[model samples]
Target: MEFHWCKRAQRQQGVAIVEFTLALPLLLLTLLAFGELGRMLYQYNSLLQGSRDAARFVASRAWNATLGKVEVSPDLECMTKYVAVYGAPSTPPCSLTGMPANTTVQVTKLAGTNDHVQVTVSYVFSPLIASGLPAFVGNSVALNFPLVATTVMRAL
Candidate 1:
C-alpha cells in the first residue's frame, strides 16, 4: 500500500500564512490587553499614592485634642498638589494636572478615635484611551474607570 503524502503536503503550502493571518489579530489583541492592564494598574497606583500622601499630610496636621479634630484647611486644596508635586504639597508651583475633575478629599475621624485621620481621594480616571479595547486603547467602547484610594493613619 503506497501512501500519497505529496498531495497532502502540497495542499498545506499556505497553511502557515493562513494560520498567522487568522491568529495575528488575536495575538496582537492579547499583547495589547496586557499592556493596557499594566497602564491601568500604574494609573491606579498613582492615584493610590496620591491618597496616601494626602492622608499623611492630613494626619500630620496639628490635632486639637480638645476640639476632637485636626486643624486642616477647610477646602483641602493640598490634595491636587499632593498627587502632582510629590512631597511638596506646600510652597509655589503646585501641580493641578494630578487631580481630575470632581476630585474629592474627605478627612473624617475613625469613629471613636479622634486622633485618627482618614483621607479619601476619589477621581473618575477617564483613561487616556477613549476605550478599553486592545491595540487601540480607544476603540468603540467607552470606559470610565473610577479610581479611589483612601489612607488612614493616626495623628502624629
Candidate 2:
C-alpha cells in the first residue's frame, strides 16, 4: 500500500504546475483588463474635473455685465483650451503626461435668457493591449474609444 501511494504522489507532483501554467495567461489577461479599466476611469475623472475648472474660469472671466452676455474671444478660447488640457492658462501649451495628443477642448458661450458658458474636453483612450484579441462576430474592432467631458455654468 505504501509503495502504491508513493507512486501516485510522484505522478501527481506536476499536476499543480501544469494547471497553473494553463491558467496563467487567462489570469494575467483578466488582471490587465481590470487595470486598464481603472486607468480609463481615472483619466475620465481627470478630464471631467478639468472641464469643470475651465468652465468656471471662463464663466468668471468672460462675463460682460454691460452686454448681458458672455464675451468669448479668440484669446479666451485658447486660454480655456490650455486650462482644460494643462490645468492652467499657459502661454505655450505644455504637454500633459498621459494626455493623448488628439485631445481637443472647445469653449462655447450660449446666448439665451441666462447666458452660460460650456467647456468640452474630448480624449481618445488607447488601451495598452492595442490588438490580438479575437473577434467572433466579424472583423476585429479597434479598442480605442473616446472620453468626453462637458461642463456648463452660468457666466458670472
Candidate 3:
C-alpha cells in the first residue's frame, strides 16, 4: 500500500511546477501594473498637498509691486520652492527615491474673485509605460503621464 501511494505521488510530481510556470508571467505583470498605479497616485497626492500649502501661504501675504499697480509677490517663488522640496532644509522625497521630479508651481487669482487664489502643481512622471500596457491605457498616452494638481481657496 505504501509503495502504491508513493508511485501515485511520483506520477503527479510535475503538476505543480507546470501550473506555476504557466501562471508566473501573468502574476509578474499584475504586480508591475499595481506598482505603476500606486506610484502615480502617490506622486499626484503629494503634489496636490504641496500646491495647497503654497497657495494658502501666498494668499496670506501682501501683493507684489508692479509699475503702478501690484504684481505677484516675489515671495511666491520662495514658498513654491520650499513646498516643492517638501519644506525648508529638506530635499524632495521623490528626489531621494530616484523618481522623475520636475515640479513647476503656478499661482493665479480667480478671474472673477480677486480674493481667491488658484495654485497649480505639475510633475513629470518617470518610467515610461510598458508596451504591453498601451492597450489598456491608450497608445497615445503610453509615455510618462503628466501629473498635475490644482487647489483654489479664498485669500485672507
Candidate 4:
C-alpha cells in the first residue's frame, strides 16, 4: 500500500509540471497585453496635449500678419511640432521629430465672427502590439485609428 501511494504522488508531481509549462506562455502574453495597453494610453494623452499646444500657438500669433486682424495665425510648421502628424493612421503614428503626410492642420476664422480661430489636429493611433495579435480584437478594426484634437481660442 505504501509503495502504491508513492507512485501516485510521483504522477501528481509530473502532472503539475506539465500544467505549469502549458500555462506559462498564456501568463506571459497577458502581461505583455497589459503593458501594451498602458503604452497606448500614454500616447493618446500626449496627442491631446499636442493639440492644446497647437491651439495656443495659433491664438498667440500676430493676426495682422495673416488675416489682417488681431487674432492668432495658423502656422503648419509650428503646429506640426506641437502634435503628431500622420498621413495614414497606422501607416505612421505621431512623431515628435516630424509630421507625416496624412496629418492635417486646419486653421479657420469663425464663420460669423472675426476674432475667433479654430485649430484642428488629426492623427492616427497605432496599437502598441497589433502585428502579433489576431485581427478583430480591438474596438478599432485594426485599421487607421482616428485621433483628433480641436480647440477654439481668441486671437492673442
Best by TM-score: 2
lDDT of candidate 4 over 26-114, digit per residue (tens): 99989987887797677667666766666666566535655567543224434434433432222223333454665666666667777
Can you write out model 3's per-residue Cα lDDT over 1-156, one digit (the tens) per residue?
Answer: 999999999999999999999999999978888888898888788888787787766666524333322234545545544655464412223123322347766777667755677778888777534633336554644456578888887766
Instruction: Point out where model 3 deviates above 4 Å.
Output: 1-12, 63-71, 89-101, 128-141
Error of 3 at 26 (Å): 1.1
Which prediction has the highest lDDT against the true structure? Answer: 2
Error of 4 at 79 (Å): 5.6
The alpha-carbon lDDT assigned to residue 134 of candidate 3 equals 39
Decide which is better by lDDT, 1 or 4: 1
Clashes (backbone N, CA, C under 3 Å), per candidate, total 1, 0, 0, 3
- Using lDDT as the yardstick, the better of models 3 and 4 is 3
lDDT of each: 0.66, 0.86, 0.66, 0.61
Model 2: CA > 4 A from native? 91-100, 111-113, 131-138
Lowest lDDT 10-mer window, candidate 2?
91-100
Better of 2 and 4 by lDDT: 2
What root-mean-square deviation over C-alphas does model 3 reach?
6.7
TM-score of 4: 0.64
Span of ten consecutive residues with least summed lDDT in model 4: 86-95
